[model samples]
Target: MNTNDATRATAETMPDLFALASSMEDDMHKVSDLAFLINDYLTRGDRITLEMQQALCWPASELVEVGRKLRAHSVALYAASKRPATLLNEETRP
Candidate 1:
Protein backbone atom coordinates (compact mmCIF):
# COMPACT_ATOMS: atom_id res chain seq x y z
CA MET A 1 0.00 0.00 0.00
CA ASN A 2 1.07 3.54 -0.63
CA THR A 3 1.52 6.01 2.23
CA ASN A 4 -2.02 7.37 2.04
CA ASP A 5 -3.53 3.90 2.05
CA ALA A 6 -1.23 2.85 4.86
CA THR A 7 -2.26 5.89 6.86
CA ARG A 8 -5.92 5.12 6.41
CA ALA A 9 -5.42 1.52 7.50
CA THR A 10 -3.69 2.73 10.64
CA ALA A 11 -6.47 5.13 11.52
CA GLU A 12 -9.09 2.44 11.07
CA THR A 13 -7.42 0.06 13.53
CA MET A 14 -6.82 2.31 16.56
CA PRO A 15 -8.77 1.63 19.71
CA ASP A 16 -11.93 3.47 20.38
CA LEU A 17 -10.78 5.54 23.35
CA PHE A 18 -14.31 6.06 24.65
CA ALA A 19 -15.16 2.36 24.56
CA LEU A 20 -11.99 0.99 26.20
CA ALA A 21 -12.19 3.35 29.16
CA SER A 22 -15.76 2.40 29.92
CA SER A 23 -15.01 -1.34 30.11
CA MET A 24 -14.45 -2.28 33.74
CA GLU A 25 -12.84 -5.66 33.10
CA ASP A 26 -9.65 -6.43 31.23
CA ASP A 27 -8.30 -9.52 29.51
CA MET A 28 -5.32 -10.92 31.35
CA HIS A 29 -2.22 -10.61 29.27
CA LYS A 30 -0.49 -12.83 31.83
CA VAL A 31 -1.90 -14.73 34.78
CA SER A 32 -0.42 -15.78 38.08
CA ASP A 33 -2.77 -14.50 40.76
CA LEU A 34 -5.10 -11.55 40.96
CA ALA A 35 -2.22 -9.32 41.98
CA PHE A 36 0.21 -10.98 39.62
CA LEU A 37 -2.09 -11.07 36.63
CA ILE A 38 -0.82 -8.39 34.35
CA ASN A 39 -3.23 -6.78 31.98
CA ASP A 40 -1.94 -5.25 28.76
CA TYR A 41 -1.14 -2.10 30.72
CA LEU A 42 1.83 -3.80 32.34
CA THR A 43 3.68 -3.64 29.04
CA ARG A 44 3.83 0.15 29.23
CA GLY A 45 2.14 2.59 26.82
CA ASP A 46 -0.92 0.65 27.76
CA ARG A 47 -4.40 1.46 29.09
CA ILE A 48 -6.45 4.62 29.11
CA THR A 49 -5.66 7.47 31.39
CA LEU A 50 -7.60 7.44 34.65
CA GLU A 51 -10.78 9.48 34.49
CA MET A 52 -9.26 11.85 37.02
CA GLN A 53 -6.28 12.33 34.72
CA GLN A 54 -8.52 13.38 31.87
CA ALA A 55 -10.46 15.87 33.98
CA LEU A 56 -7.37 17.75 35.11
CA CYS A 57 -5.12 17.37 32.08
CA TRP A 58 -7.21 18.02 29.03
CA PRO A 59 -5.01 18.34 25.96
CA ALA A 60 -2.09 16.32 27.28
CA SER A 61 -4.29 13.45 28.37
CA GLU A 62 -6.26 13.71 25.17
CA LEU A 63 -3.07 13.50 23.15
CA VAL A 64 -1.31 10.63 24.93
CA GLU A 65 -4.47 8.69 25.74
CA VAL A 66 -4.88 7.78 22.07
CA GLY A 67 -1.55 5.96 21.89
CA ARG A 68 -1.88 4.30 25.31
CA LYS A 69 -5.20 2.77 24.42
CA LEU A 70 -4.00 1.69 20.98
CA ARG A 71 -1.41 -0.46 22.73
CA ALA A 72 -3.79 -1.89 25.31
CA HIS A 73 -6.57 -2.85 22.96
CA SER A 74 -4.58 -5.22 20.81
CA VAL A 75 -7.13 -6.59 18.35
CA ALA A 76 -7.96 -3.02 17.48
CA LEU A 77 -4.36 -1.82 17.59
CA TYR A 78 -2.96 0.71 15.16
CA ALA A 79 0.41 2.34 14.81
CA ALA A 80 0.08 5.97 15.91
CA SER A 81 0.08 8.61 13.21
CA LYS A 82 0.01 12.38 13.16
CA ARG A 83 -1.37 14.93 10.74
CA PRO A 84 -0.49 18.61 10.90
CA ALA A 85 -3.34 20.85 9.91
CA THR A 86 -3.58 24.42 11.02
CA LEU A 87 -6.81 25.22 12.78
CA LEU A 88 -8.92 28.11 11.67
CA ASN A 89 -9.75 30.72 14.35
CA GLU A 90 -13.25 29.43 14.94
CA GLU A 91 -12.02 25.85 15.27
CA THR A 92 -9.39 26.90 17.79
CA ARG A 93 -11.84 28.89 19.94
CA PRO A 94 -13.02 27.24 23.13
Candidate 2:
Protein backbone atom coordinates (compact mmCIF):
# COMPACT_ATOMS: atom_id res chain seq x y z
CA MET A 1 0.00 0.00 0.00
CA ASN A 2 0.98 3.65 -0.14
CA THR A 3 3.10 5.28 2.58
CA ASN A 4 0.18 7.58 3.37
CA ASP A 5 -2.01 4.60 4.33
CA ALA A 6 0.80 3.08 6.39
CA THR A 7 1.37 6.34 8.21
CA ARG A 8 -2.32 6.72 8.95
CA ALA A 9 -2.61 3.13 10.24
CA THR A 10 0.43 3.47 12.48
CA ALA A 11 -0.77 6.77 13.89
CA GLU A 12 -4.20 5.37 14.69
CA THR A 13 -3.06 2.08 16.26
CA MET A 14 -2.63 1.44 19.97
CA PRO A 15 0.68 0.48 21.55
CA ASP A 16 1.67 -3.19 21.66
CA LEU A 17 0.37 -5.21 24.58
CA PHE A 18 2.59 -7.59 26.54
CA ALA A 19 -0.06 -9.08 28.76
CA LEU A 20 -3.84 -9.45 28.79
CA ALA A 21 -4.28 -8.39 32.42
CA SER A 22 -2.35 -5.18 31.83
CA SER A 23 -3.48 -4.36 28.29
CA MET A 24 -5.85 -1.46 27.66
CA GLU A 25 -9.48 -2.58 27.77
CA ASP A 26 -10.25 -0.88 24.47
CA ASP A 27 -8.19 -3.33 22.42
CA MET A 28 -10.30 -6.28 23.51
CA HIS A 29 -12.35 -6.16 20.35
CA LYS A 30 -9.37 -6.66 18.09
CA VAL A 31 -7.99 -9.53 20.20
CA SER A 32 -11.40 -11.20 20.48
CA ASP A 33 -11.96 -11.04 16.73
CA LEU A 34 -8.88 -13.18 16.21
CA ALA A 35 -9.85 -15.51 19.06
CA PHE A 36 -13.24 -16.06 17.41
CA LEU A 37 -11.63 -17.24 14.20
CA ILE A 38 -9.41 -19.61 16.13
CA ASN A 39 -12.37 -21.02 18.03
CA ASP A 40 -14.75 -21.20 15.07
CA TYR A 41 -12.40 -22.79 12.53
CA LEU A 42 -9.91 -24.67 14.69
CA THR A 43 -12.66 -26.07 16.88
CA ARG A 44 -15.20 -28.64 15.74
CA GLY A 45 -18.72 -29.68 16.81
CA ASP A 46 -21.04 -27.08 18.32
CA ARG A 47 -18.96 -24.05 17.43
CA ILE A 48 -20.07 -20.54 18.33
CA THR A 49 -21.68 -18.47 15.58
CA LEU A 50 -20.10 -15.23 14.38
CA GLU A 51 -22.83 -13.15 16.00
CA MET A 52 -21.98 -14.65 19.39
CA GLN A 53 -18.28 -14.38 18.69
CA GLN A 54 -18.74 -10.61 18.46
CA ALA A 55 -20.99 -10.18 21.49
CA LEU A 56 -18.74 -11.31 24.37
CA CYS A 57 -17.49 -7.68 24.63
CA TRP A 58 -14.41 -8.61 26.70
CA PRO A 59 -12.71 -10.09 23.61
CA ALA A 60 -10.54 -12.94 24.90
CA SER A 61 -10.03 -16.63 24.10
CA GLU A 62 -10.96 -17.68 27.65
CA LEU A 63 -14.17 -15.72 27.23
CA VAL A 64 -14.93 -17.26 23.85
CA GLU A 65 -15.50 -20.60 25.60
CA VAL A 66 -18.72 -19.06 26.84
CA GLY A 67 -20.21 -20.63 23.74
CA ARG A 68 -20.29 -23.91 25.63
CA LYS A 69 -22.64 -22.34 28.14
CA LEU A 70 -24.90 -21.00 25.40
CA ARG A 71 -26.31 -24.43 24.62
CA ALA A 72 -29.05 -23.88 27.17
CA HIS A 73 -29.80 -20.48 25.70
CA SER A 74 -30.22 -21.94 22.23
CA VAL A 75 -32.49 -24.65 23.58
CA ALA A 76 -34.53 -22.12 25.52
CA LEU A 77 -35.13 -20.04 22.42
CA TYR A 78 -36.19 -23.16 20.53
CA ALA A 79 -38.55 -24.24 23.30
CA ALA A 80 -40.13 -20.80 23.47
CA SER A 81 -40.88 -20.97 19.74
CA LYS A 82 -42.34 -24.48 19.76
CA ARG A 83 -46.12 -25.06 19.79
CA PRO A 84 -46.28 -24.79 23.57
CA ALA A 85 -44.43 -25.37 26.78
CA THR A 86 -44.77 -29.03 27.77
CA LEU A 87 -42.82 -29.12 30.98
CA LEU A 88 -42.31 -27.05 34.12
CA ASN A 89 -39.55 -26.03 36.56
CA GLU A 90 -35.98 -26.13 35.25
CA GLU A 91 -37.13 -27.98 32.12
CA THR A 92 -39.32 -25.06 31.17
CA ARG A 93 -36.41 -22.65 31.41
CA PRO A 94 -34.03 -24.70 29.30
Global lDDT of each model?
0.39, 0.43
Q: Which candidate wins on TM-score?
A: 2
Once model 2 is optimally superposed onto the true structure by TM-score, how far is the C-alpha of residue 51 displaced, in angstroms?
18
Q: How close is every model to the real structure, measured as TM-score? A: 0.23, 0.28
Per the 3 Å backbone cut-off, how many clashing residue pairs does candidate 2 have?
0
Displacement of residue 58 (Cα, Å) in model 1 is 36
Q: Which stretches of candidate 1 lie over 4 Å from their true place?
A: 15-33, 37-94
Which residue pairs show collisions in model 2?
Answer: none
Model 2: lDDT of residue 81: 43
What is the TM-score of candidate 1? 0.23
lDDT of 1 by residue, 7-84 (tens): 655555333333443442343211122232234334545444354244445354443554455346643322122322
